[model samples]
Target: MSSMSARRGSRIGRGMAWAILIAAVLVTVFPFYWMVRTALTPAGDLFADSHALWPHHPTLINFKRVLGMTSAERARAAGGSGAQINFLWYTLNSIIYSAVIAIAQTFFCAMAGYAFARLRFPFRDALFGILVAALMVPPIFTLLPNFTMVKNLGLMNTFFGLVAPSVLMTPFAVFFLRQFFLSIPKEVEEAAVLDGVGRWGAFWRIIVPMSRGPLITIGLTTTVWAWKDYLWPLLVGRGEHTRVLTVALGVFLQQSPNTQPDWTGLMAGSTLSVLPVLVLLIFLGKRLVQSLNFSGIK
Candidate 1:
């Protein structure tokens, strides 16, 4: 009877967990659903609640507008080229920026984490503690200073300005990586050292290969954050020459003199922007979860 009761309880718990997950997914996905719904609706009655759940006359016009494909159509074609946005350029810039940050962030964080975890150095704990304290300070607090520094370096309106401060060495990356490195067994390194491998060599050859899980997690995380970054890019990249996708998307929506938003095109751009992350999450989900668990985030 007790065994049966336990089985029943386990089943109940699993069911409840799934119920909660479904609810959370619905909450998270509903906004995107609504955005697409709005995008599909005809421009004439976009604000009408009666048609809010579903469009009266669903059309691809909005996507066409966002992609500049609708410019030839009577609905939006009359708008001169002067009004069109250079979304493709900004998107490429975003891709380049995020990719660079991910690579640099992963390598730097892993090396720093190895130092903290294995290498004996003076003031290591003190320096790490300082890094931890730095995390508590919100990034927004440093924006003005960052901007000033960028200006002083004459990096404003340049990719270097955006990449230099953020991509190179962030405190959070160090912290997360350090936590992961802690979970690695010291015996492996000791064995490698006994086998005549030097410290740096052991880390490069032995340690890093075993820690692919954690590195990929950190890389994905850094990529996602770098891609989503808007404020920093907006501040440093004023002209179209340096604008990333996020700021360009904002500009796209607000371009109409009447402040009229383009629902379809906006959703299309957003969906496109989100595609890479979604694909990444799908591919990395297992590794990410395992890494997080191994890194001590129970």
Candidate 2:
């Protein structure tokens, strides 16, 4: 009788779990479905079937037109270049900034987090407390001061302006890495120290290799943030020569046709923009989830 009751309860819980999983998947995927559907809709009928969630007659003209515009922008840029938008250069610039910040943040943030998590130091708790306090200050509050500092340093409209600000170890990255570092056993570090390895040496040769889970997590997080960053990149990268993909994308949308905006083209461009992040997530999803599990999410 007890075994029969346990089986009934297990079946009920399993049914509920499956239902919740399907609902979650639908909620998350509904937006992408809409984006693609809109991208395929005829510009003329965009408002006709307002509730339509699927494409009736998919078209390729939008893709051709968007690609053509993207190409023209590149050719014009290869020449002396004037005030017109240059998607290629801007895209290249965004990639460079994002890649650099990903590498820098991973390297520097890991080291800083290790020190904070393990090493003995004067005012360690107090210093970490200050850093935690910094997390409360909204990024908007720092924009003006950062802009002014950039201008004073003659870095306005330059790569330095875009990347230097992002290179700093953010509070979130430090906290993420610190949680993973704390999970590591201290005896391993002590063994390295007793074997004549210096602090930096052990960190480079031992700790880093062992901390791959959190490192990959932080790298992916930073890369995604850098790719989607718009406000700061727009302010510092205003010129056609330096505009990033987000800015270039906005400029393209602003010039769409009135009756039937280029749906296919917008979708193609957007799909391309999202491809990298999606691929990275697919490959690193396990590592990302592991870090989050250890970190205790806010």
Note the residue pairs that clash in candidate 2.
62-265
Instruction: Kindly provide the TM-score of model 2 when superposed on the true structure, using C-alpha atoms.
Output: 0.77
- Those runs of model 1 whose alpha carbons end farther than 4 Å from true positions after fitting are 1-23, 41-59, 69-82, 289-298
Instruction: Give the Cα lDDT of each candidate.
Output: 0.78, 0.74
Instruction: Give one digit per residue, the lDDT tens place, for model 2 in 84-200.
Output: 444446657778878899999889989989999899999988888898898998988988799888889988778878788879778878877877788889988888888999888
- Candidate 1 C-alpha lDDT tens digits along 197-239: 8888899998899888778878877888899999998898967
Give all candidate RMSDs, comma-separated: 3.9, 5.2
